[model samples]
Each structure stands twice: as C-alpha cells, then as structure tokens.
Target: MFTRFRLASTLAEFLGTAALVLIALVLSEITPVSYFVATSLAITLAAIVFIFGPISGAHFNPAITFGMWTARRIGTLRATAYVAAQMLGGLGAWQLYQYLNDKAVPAQSVTFNTTIWLAEAVGAFVLALGITAAISRAVDSLQWAVTAGATYFVGIMIASTASAGYLNPAVAVGLRSWNAAYVLGPLVGALVAVNLYHLLFSPSAVPVKRKR
Candidate 1:
C-alpha cells in the first residue's frame, strides 16, 4: 500500500468516486428518483462498496479519507493521493452534469446559523461513525451498506431544513457547490469519529485493512 499498486489504486479511486457522483448527479434530478435522494445514494453507494471496497476502500468522500487517515488505517501520502483522486472524480462528474443538463448547477450554500451548523455536523458525524464502525469490526458488507445508507438517510432527514446534505467535501466539488458548513461539518465529524472510536472502542493503534 505504498503507492506501489501495479494496478494503480489511485486510478481506481478516481473511477469509483466519479461513478458515485455521477449516479447522484444524474439520478437525483430525474423526477421520481429525485424525490428519493437517500434511496438513490444508498443503492449506488452499496454497489460501489461491494465492487471497490477492496480496491481503494471506495472512499469517494474527503471526509472518509480523512477519517481513515486519522485512524492510521492509511498512511498520510496514500490518504492525500486518495483525496486528490476523489476531488478529480467529483470535478469530472460536475462537468459532465453541467454539460448534459445544458445549464449551470445551482449554488447551494447553506444559511449560516448555529442550528444549521449543528445539523450539518450531526449528519456528518453519524455517517463517519457508521463508516468507522464498519471498518473496525467483522461486520458484513451488506450490513455495512445498510448502516451507511441509513446514516445518510437519517442525516438528510434531520438536516432537511438546513444544509444541502453535502456530507462530503469531495462530493460537493463534484456537484459544483461549496459551503463552509458542508466542508467544516464533515471534517470535524470525521476527525471526532476516528478519535472517539480509538478512545472508547479500540484503543489499539493497529490499522484496519481496506478490504474490511
């Protein structure tokens, strides 16, 4: 895992993340499916995890990459490379989305307020928590899928009145939007999650493998 994958895991991360943002961009705007943002994300993300979870850990979000790095499950350089790949993937999706739609994607910054900030923070925190737990233990991939999907669902529902449910900074780039709430909330949440897990659940410094 020393940037020495002959298969080039960074490329894999690029492709995997591009696919995820593409699914969200295209599917979430198409009427019936658009109404079910959580459903679309859950299904697409579950499939992605099944396929790329082993390859690049399917970390399509910077927050997830940051969480893994904080937990020492990945080296700093690998994590940085993965994050770059994710941002590129997001950018690609946003470009394609704009081209296909023939219109500018809406700017989606959240209104700043304590309540809104907390909403975004809590949503991101829950997602980071589930992702960290899934990686930490011998949980089923299917279960991981459900837990992650549900976390998104719950988070979105809770923050419905506030943030745009960006939950990920990389995904924000893919969607062609940036909000301080979206960025800071997820970063804080993911950082807390990795540290909290080690402090309370597993104090051992041993890193979890990517495939798990």
Candidate 2:
C-alpha cells in the first residue's frame, strides 16, 4: 500500500504539473492581456486541483512541497520525489509546447531586482496561506480547489507588475525564469507562510478555555 500510494502520488504530480505548465505556456503566448492570462490560469488551477487533489494533494509546485516538508506534513523522501517529478513535468510541458507550436524554444530572460523578489515573495505568501488555511479547515476537495484558484488569481494579479508572477517554482522552471528571485523568493515566502499559519492560525494555536 505504501508503494502503491507513492507511485500514484508521483504520477499525479507529474501529470498535474504538466497540464498546468502546458496551459500556462499556451496562454502566455496567445493572450495579450495579463489579467486574462491570470484569470485563465486561475480557472485551470482550480480544475487541476479538483481532479488531482485526492490523489496527491495536488502539489504542482516545489515551493509547496518545501512548505509541506517544513511543516512535517510530508516525509522528506516524498517531498524530494515530488519536487523532482514536478521539475520533470515542467520540462516535459515545455518540450510539448515547442512541438505543438512547430517552433524552437526561444531564449527568455528577466531582470532580477528587489521589487521582483518582493513581489514573488508576497505572491507566494498569499498562495501558501490559502493552502494552509484550507488544509487546517479540512475543507472538501471542491472548496480547496476554489480556495486555490482564488488565491492564485489574487497573487498573480498583485505580482504581475513587478514579476511574471510565476509564484510556483515549478511554473518558474517551465517559464524559463529560473532565477534567484523567482526561485528563492517563493521558497522563502512559502517557508514563512506555512510556519506563520501553524504558529498563529492553526487549530492548535487557538487557546482552549478551561471549564468554569
């Protein structure tokens, strides 16, 4: 059963991340408006979570995997495996996008700055906060999906000005923006977010009243 669960979870992460990256690449290319892209990505994320959350907790991001690991919610081996699978999935999606478009993958670059880093950090914080909140509440899969979608929409919209708003490290890999700002910012933000959630917002943190 343990082996079976591991296989299922790994496969789910690969496929879910692939789907997300592929859609994001296509949308980024065709959509002219950033708001529209953000909206589309949000809906796509909701759908992915609705479908895959039961199998693997729908973690398609390395930052999320890291956060879960830090919170001791997932084993270290599984977290490492998830991160590897997610990165491969991003690469797979990029290759697929190139083939579908019948074009070579173009060189992409972005300037890294404090603003971008801070934006990514803020965006990741919002995302991780929503995820942790949903988990703490033990919300149903549908509610979780909605929460994920809403948080991602808000995060992307807020961060798009200073950064591409690839709040997930896996998505950053897929987008070829694998810079320090894009990568470390989200990881740090998620780290803080998860810890903060557990420290202040988790049920355990709520003080219980003594009998009168």
Per TM-score, the best of the predicted structures is 2
Clashes of each: 1, 0
Question: 123-149, model 2: which lDDT tens digit per residue?
Answer: 999988888888777889999999999
Worst 10 residues of 2 by lDDT: 104-113
- Please list the residue runs of candidate 2 whose C-alpha ends up more than 4 Å from where it truly belongs after superposition: 208-212
The runs of at least 3 residues in candidate 1 whose Cα sits more than 4 Å from the true structure, single-residue gaps closed, are 1-7, 31-35, 109-113, 203-212
Model 1 accuracy (lDDT, Cα): 0.73
| Candidate of highest lDDT | 2
lDDT of 2: 0.87
lDDT of 2 at 133: 85
